[model samples]
Target: MSLRAIATFDVSTGGGVGHGLATWFGAALAGPLRGRLEQEQQGTAFFSASTRATERSPRQEYQPLATGWEAMRQELLHEPETAHVLYMREHLGKPLVHVRSSTIRVRRPNAEAQLLFGADCGSLDDVAFCAGAVEFLVAALDTVNPAFAWLGADAPASEETNLDWVLGRRVRDSVREARKLLRGYSWTTVCPEELSVRLGGPGALAATGAFHRVVPLSAGGCDPAGDRDRGGVHRRGRARCLRGPAPRPAARCPAVRPGPPGAALLPRGRVPLPRVTDRKREGARHADATARAVFSG
Candidate 1:
């Protein structure tokens, strides 16, 4: 119930499973900080082809310029098997929080986690980019392969194919289980594609997204000293994120500080500036009153 947002992503050509999983994790991250509530309930999401598996999955493995991303886009125009997910948004009916992961490895038995998404520092794409994305609902799940060769059956019956559907139903039934573990709630359903043809709901991990980064709230920010040159344009306004080429202030603002209230007002329309604590304002008022009293005498 509290997870008003969700995101799901996957590498386009290879590592589709990992790509799929990251989006859900990312969306869970960006939901609660409390910004303006989005007018539409969800946002678009994107999935990059896994660079990790690019070399392995013939479709996308190529030079950086060749396999970097452009080639991945053109390929999506043709088939579903490609790892990148560009169609999920318009088709799936949910918002997506697009993301990429570099240097990912499945560490098992003992368990250690680090920043799993970026390739390294100093790259824009090295940070999270939810846009420049074709969006969709990403409903992903890992369930016990329902069709596990039934020991007694000769040719696995159509019932075997229906295992995934049963899993989806399980997900719906155990939706609260995920909520309790995560300490937040959202509707969950098992919906798998391409793995098996039978239709039964499977238990799943689900989330939502759109027009967002869906990154962790505790995410480490990008560099700052790199952005100090832009001058006064942003200082007078709201804060700019230093993650990239944004402006920085504190050369100090030029607005002149007004003198005391008792000070004679110049013909120009300037109100006395309020002091931080108000003691100055009171002192200025008292002096102004004294000056007026002497002038009258």
Candidate 2:
């Protein structure tokens, strides 16, 4: 059966059974998209709480910040429910795309044709997207009802309150379907390897004892990654890393560029100026090479 059909059947049968059906379906269908609705319940309490926390003490150390899109993604990875809600909000009100509705003419006892409702099957890709979407809803439900994830078939028959096991099973099945669909396409699950590298590698996003304040670069402005004024000192070198307070080099230091390969132009010694007694003809020859390399570029 198609993924949409599977999801639709669960929603239909699950809803037909009771009073909380509409609420449950709304929660399920809305999923992470709740924040976009502007209504109270739809938006998460996390955002509200965070906002209040920020307001209470503006300079509080507990304030969370993201440096860039990649950093923001890392934060989201740590908070899946919040991420899903925001993700849904990002793509709010887009067509479901999987379930196509139509009406067909059927023969009636009065020798007249009457309209009957029907559905058009969606493509596998559409089904896969739907499956992914439904997985988000399942997660949202699980969040509302604690321990929903742990409840399973092997646990106990007595433990299946409100068909929690059934719902859990449905979610697991849908997730499996999503993974299967994903294999057929190029989509893959995102993990923390990239984040780990970004945080720990030599050219890490934030260096040790370094403060990173994210500032947006306007169009036509210097890229932040290369802007020395905002960056920290290069750990392994005397020069400042990109985004640090390295001065504009064009008018002032005609022969000096702050970072490599420009750095190669400097002589081997740490200090460029030597005492009058130590300055020799050979030093002049080295200076000539440095000048040639620097000005030639």
Candidate 3:
């Protein structure tokens, strides 16, 4: 089964933390992840596009481009080795923060090569690995630079919410939805850099013999990368482009902290992330129940 889900965050102006931290975090985690990437011949990567490239690819097939993100799904399918981290040229430009630890595997009969997310397509180890990468990246980034409050760095009142936390919220939501669709699968835990506590779930694991794709938050089209710059460094102070609803004041919600060992990171307390089914809103109910139980018990 092909299971996919997306969790999107509306980054406020100047919400993007500087690229310097991303670079530093990427390098620090690269060495530990190198062993895994070496084993698979490809570790992990991040991808984004420029406003100019995104403008041209709106109608393209197999690859879609929205002003928010430039999809490289097709290119990734063709060049798995090309995976690398990317920061958008415009910090407030609605960036696509994609991370994957996937590899090329041959399909049967035609023996066609394809790339799928989640290491080994859903093994316990695969789940652990994917989770580990996300955990490390989120922790490193959030601690180093939380997402800036709405309206950029100069906003007089700083919002308690950061980019990493918001991004993690989206990821946790998506994983909850996917898990509902993919229950009874094997599970594993990976905490390479003690970041899993920050990400919520350990990782989504693919079951044995299960052929699947882990499409995290992505644009709607498919074509691959073209003769465009893969990633670009942008200067701050660009015009603002708000796509989603305005973020509420952080004061409205309590701050989220790093969750405990083997627990999902939520503002309230420890609870496992859920898979969202048509009945999944019940999952939210259940999550609330569980949180209540934890507190009340």
TM-score of every prediction relative to native: 0.18, 0.17, 0.23
| Candidate whose lDDT is highest | 3
Better of 1 and 3 by TM-score: 3
Better of 1 and 2 by TM-score: 1
TM-score of 3: 0.23
Candidate that would win on TM-score? 3
lDDT of 2 by residue, 1-297 (tens): 122211111111211212112222334324423333343234422111111111133421111111132333333222211111112212233222211111111011000000111122233335343343334434323222111111101111121111122122222332222211110000111111222232342233234322222111111011112112111123222222211221222221112212212122212111111111212323232222211111000
- The lDDT, on a scale of 0 to 1, for candidate 1 is 0.20
Candidates 1 and 3: which is better by lDDT? 3
Query: Local distance difference test, per candidate?
Result: 0.20, 0.21, 0.22
Better of 2 and 3 by lDDT: 3
Tens digit of per-residue lDDT, candidate 3, span 1-297: 111111111121012222222322243235223333233223133233211112234332221122122243333322232133322223334322323211112111101111113222232224453444333333333322221101011111111112222223343333223212111011111121112223322222111111122112111111111101111101110100000011121212222333222222212122232222222322232222211100000
Q: How many collisions per candidate? A: 35, 9, 16
Q: What is the Cα-based lDDT of residue 291 in candidate 1?
A: 10
**Root-mean-square deviation per candidate:** 26.1, 27.5, 20.3
